[model samples]
Target: MEKWDVVVVGAGPGGSYAAKTAAELGLKTVFFERGRRPGDKNSSGCGLGQRWWRDFPEIMEALQGLPSVRKVEMVVINLVDENNRLRYRCGTTGSDLCANRWPHGMDGISIYRRDLDPFLADLAVKAGAELRTSTLVSDVIMENGQVKGVRTEKGEPVYAQVVIAADGAMSTMARKSGIRNRWGGGCTLVPQLDFSADPDKMDDVIGNAEWVWFGALYGAYQVNFRDGFHIGAGQWLREDWDEKPTDMVKKVLQFPAFQAMCRAIDAKPREYQAHLLPWLKKPPKTYTGGMMLVGDAAGFPCPLEAEGIWHALTSGKIAAETAAWAISRGDTSERALSEYERRWKASPLGKEHEFGPEFVDLWNSTIFDPKLMARQIQLLLEFSMLHPFSVVFDWGDAHMDCFNQHLEHLLDLAPQFADFGRTYLAPLARGIWPKNVKRILLSVKPRIPVLGKLPDNTFLRLVAKLSKSLAPYLDPAVNQEAPLPREVFERSRKG
Candidate 1:
């Protein structure tokens, strides 16, 4: 076919979701993948979060029958030291959020792009969108400063009413269609490795939880799958491009934590993959006369975690919604296509990018002060383990004295946490204040900064406060043990 209602480029989450939504909306939709099949050429840590499942019911319903995903029951943030010692471990069970929202009440999920991509693509296909594989869409076809379609590397032209670029960070579709000249310094480099191991052994060693490693490359991850785990790290691209991402990854590969996990699972190298990701603090220009950019093409990856699958899926659906609306109205001009940008900004995904670059980078600054983190973790552990009612194991404790001591400790630490929040996050929260009022607040900060800082801790202490407030209205959640044992999780500690 020479023309279609929409041409969706790239068959990852964004593309597939766009095509699926477009097809379901009675629009002729076709998506192209350069790989031999969907998911064949993609790789990542693949740890989907609570927002991914709880926010999108369609995703959970689709993955319900598939054996492709592993339920994430726990998430542990492993803090390592310069000497390669696992200094402390802090994270929580998904049970903290209650399982009413998650599939089977799991905390999160883990899967490989090899499994996830094809599964999502098949959904698009089943929904009546044509899937064209091994077809490289080299450039977008343009007419009178508007995107008309895409031209394949083989020189064939396919026309469409609207084009959606779901083609990832280094998007040729986005660049060729004039989304922006290039990502330039606004991208991140990530390296990943997949391993194959005995499924039963993997179940024994890793279970269903994912681990986040600090004091590694920027921020690193290790996620469990059915047979093995996926491990990866990310670093922002620099102007000079002095260091190789692989060399940085190699350092992580040699770390005690990485080795401990590998040996525990008898992990055999499955594959090494690297991809560029958009690391912008804000969304870029996403729409033009006849096209819109979704996913990494529009720079939607989280500034801190580099997580963008939800961004892809959500933006893809929104783009298709706009496409369907614009096409129905017979108006595909830039003004009509602008709806795509508007919808995406008002989405849950949009709120993620509100912070500036400095604030986003602050999350990765923990490697600078392991000792400070150690102190904080010690306080948290002491506080959490102080009384049964803290995590609410029981109401039988008459030991209000012990609880009072812990409360005093938290109060002391609260000021320090308040200081950190004021230094880092206050700028991002600036929008909450009017311009003239903001000046007044800043002027008062020098005079009454300490008194006003407690409100800042409200967000950080949300979990503790929420649980206490809801204890009467809600049933106490049953605590579950993490898949990986404490001893096993501590294997990385230097002797």
Candidate 2:
């Protein structure tokens, strides 16, 4: 039996980050993982949000050219018939593609979870956290009606004043502790089929492009190309909870529309993996007597686009900070820990969960209606192709600062989303600009379109009417205060 200050379960980005932050903060941290090595059992399409570099610059520096870093700049949305023949298709740039806009015009790289996860874990070790892989936490240890520690499979007792569950979506600790009881219809099953091949053939075409296919019962169809060697389809689904990864890959490969998109780059399935994700929602509760949850266990999914890695890392950091603060105060009570939830919601972390439900409602409605989905995909394609410039951000020296300012602007829009009803232009502007440019665009954008369809006058009229209301927020002082880093912007432009 060993007593530690904080115990993090799971070694994914969320867990590793939590441990690293905790240890660096001088907390006695112990990380328990079920995998043989740090990243042994992991599988992911590995698309990260641009925010990754903002918080964990070290991870980005370490993984700059790793084998799993998948690059994407263009996304093509297509409708595949039952036989996998493509009936309709559209392509657009990473800059203006509103699907999952990046701030700062930054494009995401898909890294192998197998490599990336371990790298983060090793970094945590370097930061002075104890890493214990192959340690399965079988049950949580409680006393005085509060969580005090956990019991591993071999019956070893590891004690901690505060417990953070980064155990991922099917969190056994969460279920055991009564934190999460169920997942909503918003859960997305991302089934991916991975392929490894020659860099030239793969990188030249797949390197710059990613695709989403509509009409599949499982969810959205995605092709992510990584490091010019690994390519996979992250097929999304809101239903068919019973389908296995192998079957999902089989069905997707047979889809006529999916086949057509694959033909352009010559892709084939080499390996298959499955991931079940819960939608963004307020966890039933994040804090208990002496315990809390982070990452997937806490139910913070990437709100609008189902991106989880960034959110997971963000929540993990928040949880670690909360734990550190609580321990320093000699208090791990529910009241002290409540600060974690409050702070998370106060920042973009909270907004991510808030916007998740709306996405769920829209995706659910559209997933079942193939024709409707096709039409929406068509509109997206049309928008991407016709208005590629606005949708893409090619800023030379102003990339990073511009993006940060933009994100700050979007955060400003948070308080107004409820008052303006559906006329919110933030998403439309964001989806169209680089994530870094999104907030800035939102500040100036008057009419925000929802669901990709709006009357031309509808948005302009709303903007005109709201101009006076928005004048105070968009003062010149705000714009001139700071811009993104010029060097990164210039380099990105060159690249």
TM-score of each: 0.76, 0.72
Identify the leading candidate in terms of TM-score: 1
- lDDT of the candidates, in the order given: 0.73, 0.65
Model 1 scores a TM of 0.76
User: Tens digits of per-residue lDDT for model 1 on 1-495?
Assistant: 599999999999999999999999999999999999888877744878777666676776576455556778888777665566765676675454576755457666788777789889999999999999999999888999999999999999999999999988888987787779877677877787778877777778777778777653445778788777767766667665566667755656767876887888788888788888787867778999899999988898887677789889989999999999999999898999998888887776766665546445565344223345445444435445543555354345555765666567778778776776777665444333233332443456445545555553342244234444222111223122212222222342221
- Which residue runs of candidate 2 sit more than 4 Å off their true CA positions? 79-88, 94-104, 184-186, 216-218, 223-248, 255-268, 368-495
Model number with the top lDDT: 1
For model 1, the stretches where C-alpha displacement exceeds 4 angstroms are 64-68, 94-97, 100-106, 356-359, 364-420, 428-495
Compared with the true structure, what per-residue lDDT tens digits does model 2 show for residues 1-495? 699999999998899999999999999999999999877776644666556666666677668678766666557666654445565566764434544443435555666777789888988899999999999888788787678888899999899989989888888888777666767554556666676555565666555566665544444546464532332333345455445556645655667554554565566557766777766534557777677888778777775566778878888888999999999999888778888888887777775554454455565445534445544444333333333353246364476665555456555654543333344333232222133333554445544447125453354445435564333223333233233223333343344
